[model samples]
Target: MEINHKIKDQITGFIAANSLVLIVMAITKYFLPPFGGGNVIIFSEFVILPFLMGIVSAWCWRKINISTRKQSAWTIYNTVIAIVLSFLVLKEGMICLVIVSPLLFAFILLGTYAGKAMFKRNNQTLNASVFVMLFGIFIADSLSVHRYENKVADTITVNAPPTEVWKYVVAYKRIEKKSDFWLFRMGMPSPVQSTAEGYYLGAKRKCIFSNGYVFDEKIVTYDENKDLTFDITNQPRDPEIMGHIDILRGQFLLKDNGNGTTRLTGNSWYRLYVFPVWYYDIWAESVTRNVHLRVMEHIKELAEAK
Candidate 1:
């Protein structure tokens, strides 16, 4: 009977900790508006909230004499549960969750250890102070504007000259080949085709993705056989994946190699509303590079075939 009672207490503690974490997360999301109309803030979602969850979990389970390994395991388990619940409640895509899991786990573990150390002393003042500091930081981060514009570029050598490459750069046929990029395979959209209505500045262009979503673009800079730049007038708001990111503009630059070859460069400018710019930017740059490669490679093939 004692053993069963202990097990029941442990289960209850675990449930209570996770419930508190989820409640805090939902409340934070409600109070803090996302930078650009999205519902995710990197600091709160990935760092602060997870850290607080860890501390709270440790406090809830403080009476249980568990090994460090077990505590770590429980923390990880809590993270996984939170992620699953986020997916179900927030309707976030699998790819987003996959990308966010590592950061969430890391911070949660840190919090768990910190919490254990603090609670081991049973010092109420320290705990309260820490909680207040974290809340202050969260409020400061929320109030500060986090609009960041970043640019990513990829270059490829094409066998065709600038003129030939220019034809495809302006517009290309459907890409029938499948993208080998792992992310795209996992439901992140890949570019499929591009169509242009006119051949000069102010012309309308549409870049279509495999998901049947189209990016409405307008030609802002058009230099025949040299530069083709377009502003993204409108893009999809799927909310599950890339909706939080705003793709501002894109450009294709062609340079004559003078030996029947051309140097083709693709550039993309975007603003991501997510926080912790260092981490998310890596994924953003990689995704942008791959997208550029897919389109540029298609252009290369078509230009060379002509």
Candidate 2:
């Protein structure tokens, strides 16, 4: 009877601890200022969120008198629950969330251990000091300079010639198979259609997104059968989704493989003005690479079809 009662207590503590973590995240994301901004990701989502989860887990373990063997279960439970809540409830992008998942889990573990230490010592001064240190770091991170440009290039050798490839390069049809890559399933925008006006320099082309986001590019350098380079003039204006990123420019270079084939190299350069560029870069790099590959593969399919 005593064993069963202890198990029940442990389960209850787990639920309550994770619930508190979810609620805190909700408050930080929704009820806070700068809604849908990078600040939310940096200060609230990454740092404080994990810290709270850690603290809660530690508190629960100590309170419930859970066995050492069962203690690790609480950490895993907390992380999985938080991820689900972030996706379904918070409406965060799956790719970024998953990219940062390891970091968040680490934070939970650190916080849990910290929580254990705090409870063991039961010293208010120690608690106060640690809180101050974390707050200072968060403040510093907010004011820190974190602007960077991430460039991603993907190459595919197409069996068709440059002329055939160039036709598909400037513009192509919608990507019918949305499930070709994991990024597409994770909400990364798939290339719908690219349409260019005129064939000379200064021509404008627009690559449309499935969600109505359009990347407007102006041709700066146009080599008939070699390279097509364009500078981004207009970007998607969706504040809730596309506001954090600014796509700068994109280029497609066609190189002769000398074997009746062409090597298509796609390049994109974008600046992320958000703070803590390193953390966000993980998501940005993955997203850009996937986005590039999807388009390149789509072009390859169309070029090879002819």
Candidate 3:
């Protein structure tokens, strides 16, 4: 028997059958914290919109009357897909989320709706299952989190002096103008507009995504010619069920290689306590380190060209 298929069946069935659990779990995940954290966030942490989805799903599994065997087989197959997608999500964050979120949601719906007659053939059952899975993500993310960390360093010897690089870093807006959202992505202009002054501590700026998602960035440190760090100090507009996720951090360090070369390093750290992650930090660091260096190279090109 394919264990993979069975896992999918269970996820779908559980979601379709346990709507109440999903609702409760969603609320729990959205609001509860790991142990030590600030409550500048009152009931500030919300999860209701998420759980209602589950309430709808459980109703579907029962109404559809999906067979136990089929549910098991499908779930097993989906588990394999879920595992692969989980690793990708941990590694790539929003990039992976954009892709996996849709596929997983689609399959989950399929498992919930396609298997009818086990409980009772009802169209509402299909609708309910979709809500159940959406709600469960809230609970699942709250209950367990898989995290990992990665560290990376890059050495780039700019012909220019460290002070020169610092100036360019300070004037990043000049290096590359912020790109606008394509017409297809969002109906609105790229909301890269923010009052956050560049390279200054406490500077704040707003960034809008193609999905109408919005977050604001705030500078935490502005060490001249040495290090620059900032944090996105707001909650995700897309999934407003959870507490403020602005706890995440990002850093850029410029070190003199003691030679003509300079070492410019970058790091990013973000996590959901409930998610079990052993090395997401490492993975994120590796990816962002190069990403920053590349940005530095572009800066170098611009500065040199002038």
Candidate 4:
């Protein structure tokens, strides 16, 4: 009977702790005015919140005087549960979940141990200092109001000549090469077809994606088979979730390899209006690289087909 009661208490406590985390996340993500809107992947959401979560969980465990092994188990369990809940209930996109969850978990775990140690030492001065640090980060992020344009380029050598590759780059007709990559499979959206009105400098190019997202580009530079640059006039947003990224400009450059092949380089520049430009740039770079690679590879396949 005593063992049964202990088991019941453990299950109840775990559920209660996880529920608290869920409520906090939901409040931060949904209820808060500015925190959860538009750019939800800011420093407060990713870094500070996870650290707070870790501290709370660790403090609870320490208070109860649980074994070290059990504390570790609880930390891992809470992090997993929070991520799963975010996906299932909060309806967060897979890109954010996969890319940012690891960092979140790491911060949470680190905070947990740090909190435990601080509590054990009863270090009120250190606790006050940590709170001040977090507040300072918030203030700095809020005050630094500047946008940055980040660029990412991917180059690949195609088997076909420059002329042939240029044709495909301008307006690709239905990429049958489906991306089975995990990102696309998880609904990141793959390119479908691209069509253009004219081949001149002022022409407009429209590229469609699987998820109904379309990018409308106006030709800025058209250097025959050498270079094609366009500035994005408009882009579609996901109907379900608000995307924090905006593509500003894109370019496709071609160089004639001495042989029968051509070197194709795809470049994109995007503006980051989100906070903490430095940290967000890392994720932005990664996402843009993936986007460039997928399109570049598809173009390579089509150019070589002939």
Candidate 5:
């Protein structure tokens, strides 16, 4: 079996160059340790970025010189995509691995061709290629998850002072409603009232979703004019159900935006989710935010109207 030696050399050289930088970054991360004052520094970010760039740069060079550059370009593109995808999956951790695998495979053909071309009989090259392949995939997924971890932030601005709106907004039994913007067509209404086990922490609250999907939430944290967050324990382990695709961390936060407006942020923090990582989240978040934003706007309008 004959391989295009020149193209093969380019791929190997690219890997060598990137790997050297990655090793240096890793060592630097180990010594410098991105840790101080409660924040865990993401050492991997510093490492994978250079490698991703190197792969892209190699693709550019190959695009001009190598006849199989088209394949190489796709390979590099997929590698970059893999990095982005890995970050997303890594954040989800448990369930997201199921998703990240297929994405990494998209580049498998090109990657293998390049790798095999580079290493004819060297066992070390084969091992190194495998190591880098796995490492790159993992780094990409980790970064994806990290990026998504803090993506959704919902804010609430109440017209009145905190003392006034805090009572109603933080109340356990208050009936919620949609703001005008959330009126998709305006016929049926969302289930606003749910029975509360208790108004404070460690107590359970029964929340009913739009289509009879039931969720049980424990009040994890409750504070006045600061934050109210709940730990949702979804009822029944049925994945086939469409109404409640995920029962994530449901939370409410209140902050002073200066002046008289009280900012309230409601969020449905993601926990466990399955593959096609982008689609479900995009769909679910749209509804969650659409509904919540409308509700918050109504609160604002109502508060201001008075």
Candidate 6:
């Protein structure tokens, strides 16, 4: 009977800890400002909140007399549950969730270890003080402003001269070739065609993607076969992932190699609203590079064709 009673207590503690973690997540999301524009992904969401959830889980386990040896496994299990719940309840895209999983797991584990150390002496004062400090940090982080801008460029050597490449750079027909980019294959938008209303500055340009989404661009700088630059006047609104990023400008620079070939370089400037710029920037750069390559490759094919 004692063994059964102990098992029941463990189960009860597990349930309570998980419930508290979910509640904390919901409350934190409610209080934090929405991502993008004036709001950004703060440290609290990726770091502090997971840490607090770990501590809360440890507290519940300690109250139910769970052994220290088993706390690590229990904490991991609790975090997995919480993540699954977030995916279901929040309706987050799989790509976004996958990208964030590593950070969440790492911080939660650190918090669990910290909690273990704090509870060893069973000091309520220390625990309360730490909680207060964490809360203060969260508040301060929320009130601060964070904006990040990044640039990515891709260069390709085309078999044609600057004049031939320049024709396609201004505007091109539909790309009939299938995209080989992994992200585009997985449903991320890929460029399909581009059209220009005029051949001079202030011309209206439209770059259409496979998903029927079009990027509205205005020609800011036009230098015949040498340089073409445009500002993104409008972007697609349908894709949920697009909400976290804004593309500011795009440019194509054509240089004559003087050996019957041209060097085509594509440049883009964008702002990312996601947190931990170091991590997401890699993805952003990769996606942008692939987009540039895809478009430039199509231009190469057309320009080189007899």
RMSD of each: 2.1, 4.0, 11.2, 3.7, 11.7, 3.4
What clash count does candidate 3 reach? Answer: 54
**Residue ranges of candidate 5 with Cα displaced over 4 Å:** 1-151, 172-191, 235-244, 301-306
Candidate 6 Cα misplacement greater than 4 A, ranges: 1-37, 63-84
| TM accuracy, model 4 | 0.81
**What's the candidate order when arranged by decreasing lDDT?**
1, 6, 4, 2, 5, 3
How many residue pairs in model 1 have overlapping backbones?
0
Reference-based lDDT, each prediction: 0.84, 0.75, 0.46, 0.75, 0.51, 0.80
Please report how far candidate 1 places residue 196 from its true position, in Å. 0.8
Tens-place lDDT digits, model 1, residues 1-306: 867766765666567766876786676667645533454465665688788878877777777788889878887788788788878887778888888888888888888888889999988999899999998887777667677779999999999889889888888999999899999998898999999998999999999998898999999999999999999999987655455578999999999999999999999999887878888888989999999999999999999999
Query: Per-residue lDDT of 1-306 in model 6, one digit per residue for the tens?
Result: 877766665566457656766676566568645533353566676788788767765665554566655766766676677668767886666666666777777777788778878987789899899999998987776666778899999999999999899989989999998888887887778999999999999999999988799999999999988999999999997434654679999999999999999999999999987776877788889989999999999999999993
RMSD of candidate 5 to the truth, in angstroms, is: 11.7
On TM-score, the candidate that comes out on top is 1
Where is model 4 poorest over a 10-residue stretch in terms of lDDT? 33-42
Better of 3 and 6 by TM-score: 6
Q: Tens digits of per-residue lDDT for model 5 on 1-306?
A: 135766565566455544554454456445543322122223233333443434433433442344455555545544554445444532323233333334443434334454444444446666577668857764554444322232356886687776665555543343454434333334323445355665677778776544465668788887866777877776544333222244567777777778987877887775323223353456456656765765566556656665
By lDDT, the better pick of 4 and 5 is: 4
Worst 10 residues of 1 by lDDT: 31-40
After TM-score superposition, the amount by which residue 88's alpha carbon in candidate 5 deviates from its true location, in angstroms, is: 32
* Native-to-model Cα distance after best TM-score fit, residue 124 in candidate 2, in Å: 4.5
Off by over 4 Å in 1: 1-6, 31-42
Pairwise lDDT winner, candidates 2 and 3:
2
Model 4 misplacement above 4 A: 1-41, 67-69, 84-91, 239-243, 273-283
lDDT of 2 by residue, 1-306 (tens): 877866665666557766876775566556755433454345445766577667766765665565545556667777777788778776666665676677777777778778888977889898888878876775565454455677888888999999989998887888877656676675666677888897789999999987777888899988987999999998875543454578899999999888989999999998774435667777777778878888888899998999
lDDT of 3: 0.46
The TM-score obtained by model 3 is 0.45
